[model samples]
Target: MKLLSFRVKKSHLLLVGILLVAANLRAPFTSLAPLLDAIRLDFSLSAVQAGLIQTLPLLAFALFSPLAGSIAVKYGIERVIFAALLLIAAGIGYRSYGGLFGVYGGTVLIGLGIAMGNVLLPSLLKRDFPQRVASMTGLYALIMGVGAALGSAAVVPLSQLSALGWNGALFAMLLFPLLAMAIWFPQLSHGAARLAIAGEPQQRSGSVWRAALAWQVTLFLGLNSLIYYVVVAWLPSILRYQGFSAEQAGSLHGVLQLATAVPGLFTGHLLARMKDQRAIAVTVSLLAAAGLLGLLALPAFATLWVVLFGIGAGSTIILGLAFIGLRSGTPAQAAALSGMAQCVGYLLAVGGPPGVGLLYDATHSWHGPLLICAALALVMALVGYLAGRDRCLTPAEPLNEGRLSEEER
Candidate 1:
């Protein structure tokens, strides 16, 4: 009954491909994070220019996000994903070996590829394996986290290998996407038609863009991301300035991502027990602030500080996702809120790297940037409280009432 084509269990191949793509979602960026200064130094990139390297992918993700879902609808998810893998591979290869054009161009492609994968994979999971959506989605998230951690950790070591410098290390990642493409290629012809999800018209009874609760959730998600990515893009350099060696800083960067993935293990249990998540939100945001301040005030304990920051950053990432579901009253509202939050949230993240870079460039000191993000972390705490209030995006229906969506059923 579960037979797919040619003795394949249909879902098995699909699951493999989906998981492969999930692992790739954050790997490309995390791999490059610790190597950012190397890239900057090699190209003589100004601080702001180096920041753009980090920002470009986020910018591209934001700009392309709204369109990816629709594009997948028309062309088919499998085909889009197939192409996305290709882009990611090409991006990595180009970014590693080529000149400036290759650098920025490659990042854009990676972003586009990641955007499609991030946007569509969950829907694909729901469509193909509705019964296992929750578990599959959790696995998907875990894979992304672990993949990112590995990428962050592995790059410096790989780059240190003779005849395979930073660019070579980046290029080595091509093997993953290439392998994924091979794993996924077998289904390219069979899937687009057989697994196609039926399309639905975009529904907006009231635009989530206009809702106050929507803005609160949006700001919370946005600010948290801004702080998180600032850390991702700059933590290594920040630590290095404090006299940690490249290897040590790189290891800690990996730790940050690994810690992020840890939250998934406990998130389900914690959320189930909480009546509302306001306290949770404030706690995480404060954790982030404390860690940031610790970085400045307690430089000797950088390891503890980074772990705290990592936990706080990781928690906020989950909180952002949870708020999307917790605050929406209807499925349609959730859909709209999701689109709005992600688009706006990533847009906010797009500015964080370069903005911090600009500060660093101006002041020639890390203290100002660290202090600024710490202050923003406090702001995230305030927004988290408002966003976490026990309220719906709109009173479309009551969340616990188990009402159907506003769209025609």
Candidate 2:
């Protein structure tokens, strides 16, 4: 009875720790945008250079993601996550005082930390909540979205506090990881025992690499991420040009981020209920396209379009994540697919924002860049359709499980 009770307690503790870890994943990435202009001015950076700064983390995520699986396999997910959080805290704290080199160095560290966390979390969710993978993934995404919104919303206020300054704003991020570390420490102590139960031996599956559905899912994920990050990095600037105050522009950006959380909360439930997620994906992509067009054609109504874009983008994000689990034949496949998707997709995505900024700088107008994004959205829709068909990523599975099964065969 005592042992059973202890097991229950450990499970509860583990859940809480996972939630906290999820909450910390996105804050560091999104929080810096609100302060970008201020930092740019202080450092005398051009728009392109500033955009590159914002692009660094995405680049890090892309570059480091492929290695995350190998690292997690050897070190254990919990240890890597905990260590990553500490690195994030250190990076955030260090950047508070550094010069340009220090800032970039620290940002790279933060990005690497986030990359490890991002690649591992879904696998962790799969391991911990295998029966409720979709639901737990939705919750995880929701918390991450909330964390991002909070980080973006808090930067200005944090910087304004009497003694805080910009450094204070950056340092504020350290608190979340520190708290998460405290909560996660106990789990690390039992890491070896858990590994033993789960088996420490690594088994590589050959099917994941040969799958066509895997590439489709990865492309869809990448395209969606490109669109999302482009907006996150530049939407405020776009709004600023539309004659809104800096604060209002930042608020709009924050609203878009906040809206992402809503779909995340419901996506798992929706995926579980409906096998064919293609129609939903197509509709959401159209909404995202409309929102972007709305911003371009009707800048005066930025708020409405931003909201539309947010909902559309947010929903698509949830759907893309759902594919990570739904399309994979097993948990290990899911993790492998996730690692492949994020690595390749994010590397593709890393170009979106900086590319947009460079185009904007050269063309001296937002129209060209906006149009390019719209085209990308169309591609996202097409790929999403191909990916959304109800079939496992393994080639042996036919399309008939959910939708277009007969046609696919």
Candidate 3:
């Protein structure tokens, strides 16, 4: 019966809205990656400042994510989502204008908007699509990858147009959040129902922060974010140093993101059937690590390396998101876990881009930075092993219950 409820067709529109929201989450950030050098030159910014711009969103995610659920609880998730979309739209629009203030300020807004969506979307999925958490997460995650690809790919071409330039190219991204807002508006009509559907009173326990399992999940997520964002922020620069043109680098970055979407197609079902995800976790970790090693040793085969990294990173993302659902006993627990993981996880992630840039600046080569990433990938694998254990975070409970626990599976 619960499964059938999750399969109902009436909620299709809501699912579209959810995917659309996911789409907006990454486009605003990834669009800037391809143009980082251009923005840096135009603003006369230092390497550290450029990295700081890239780090702003992660910082926002860390600072604002915990508050998103509380705000949703008070204002309703749908209303909060509506506001977040507006915030993204406004931020992107303002950011299109050239200046340091416009850049940093708009980024802050975009980051804050995305942070709320980040914390709320998983909770929304768990609450409304309890039986379909993995599949639904995969679907949204796939859309996110697509949006990222489109953003990274299009920005280069769009900037070439005489009328658009980088500013217009950036302003063009506002279409996503604006379109998401249009689709999301109807959800606000059922605010009370959405509030009830998105969280449960009994599961609203504060115990997730203390659970060892939860910390493992949080570290897994944080390490993944650190690796992924470092790649996003600096991959183009690394490729450029390897002799790829800006357009070619951007195109390759797009390919990397497109590669990420592939695993989302089947990983959900795979995760659903697995008793424990440790094997899957280890495989992705090794794949990404190998890719990093390839980039450092054989820049000639950059495409292959990028694709491998993308697959591992993308698949791990689906697993990380699925863990939030798989490890929790209820929707509210999922929300709390999401908030806890993302807040602490993203806080740790804030160091990735800037750290890489700093390392590069100090050593004057990509070797040191790439080596650092490779090391982190190994750490990520260890964290993934812990997070992948078949256990459940019982509501209001500080300890993990059991392997393939009934409450979780």
lDDT values for all models: 0.76, 0.78, 0.84
Residue 398 local lDDT, model 3: 53
Q: Candidate 2 on 73-143: residue-level lDDT in tens? A: 66667788898898898888777778777678788889899888877777676667766666777777888
Report the Cα lDDT for candidate 3: 0.84
Between the candidate structures 1 and 3, which one is better when assessed by TM-score? 3
What's the residue-level lDDT of 346 in candidate 3?
A: 88
Give the clashing pairs for model 3. Answer: none
Listed in order, each prediction's TM-score against the native is: 0.78, 0.88, 0.87
lDDT of 1 by residue, 224-329 (tens): 8888888877899999999999999978876777777887666545755665779988998999999999999988998888888878877777677666656665
Off by over 4 Å in 1: 1-13, 34-50, 96-99, 125-138, 160-167, 185-198, 203-206, 236-251, 272-276, 325-336, 360-368, 385-409
> What TM-score, to 2 decimals, does candidate 2 have?
0.88
